[model samples]
Target: MESSMKKPAPDQHDFHFWTDEKFRIADTDLNGHINNNAVGQFYEAGRGEIISSVLGPPAKRSIGAALARVQIDYLAEAHYPGMARIGSRIARLGTSSITIAQAIFVEGRCIGMAESVIVFLDKATRKPTPMPDAVRDGFTLLG
Candidate 1:
């Protein structure tokens, strides 16, 4: 089955935050290219950096963030023995959620892109809650 959650691909210039991840030899598959799962992990790493940058460390924040949904589109093949340059930015920010748009590049060429929806949760109740003003303000700068 195909997913209909596609969004526009982002260029490197559109990113507000950048993360470079080394490709592990183990990330390769029988086809000798980085596997689809590795591409998803690249997005995860980018999102982690975004969260850390916008929300600070876990102990410093009143609320926790959780991944609600992610849609990845693979556009090209990436081989091992190189770095994956992942770029991330806030595509949308809501009262309790933020949507991150990201892309992965190898050798300056875009290989994949993803959109991740993250929701803020109350640490005590573990339920979605409104984000604090400070947190919202921080993310706004990345948009």
Candidate 2:
């Protein structure tokens, strides 16, 4: 699929939360490039980090969060034996969900960009739940 990120390239300064990921040899495909699945994992790690930092750990929260949807655009191929810098930021917030904007950079170049939606759920019923005031306020600071 084509992504609008093709032109003007993504800038790291647009993101607030950053996660450092190592591109392992095992993450490479037969073509000697890092696979798409591996790139997704990097995005997951970045999302987890930003969530934990903003809302605290999962074990202590009354509400849980789950990834509802994700759209990633492969802008360039990434190779192994390199470091991936994943950048994440809250793009939009809803009553029960948050939309995250992300970009993956390898060797200082943007390789991919993604947007993910995460829904808040009640821990007991597992149904969609409204975000707490404190939680909303916390994430607002980051955005």
Which number leads on TM-score? 2
Put down candidate 2 lDDT per residue, 14-41, tens digits, no spaces: 8888999998988999999999999999
lDDT of 1 at 37: 88
Task: Quote the lDDT for 59 in model 2.
Answer: 93
TM-score per candidate, in order?
0.92, 0.93
Pull out the clashing pairs in model 2. none
Candidate 2, residue 99: the lDDT equals 96
Q: Give stretches of model 1 more than 4 Å off.
A: 1-8
- Model 1 lDDT per residue over 1-143, tens place: 96688666667888869999999999999999999988888899899988999778878978999999998889999898999999999999999999998899899899988889999999999999998999999999988
Ten contiguous residues with the weakest lDDT in model 2? 1-10
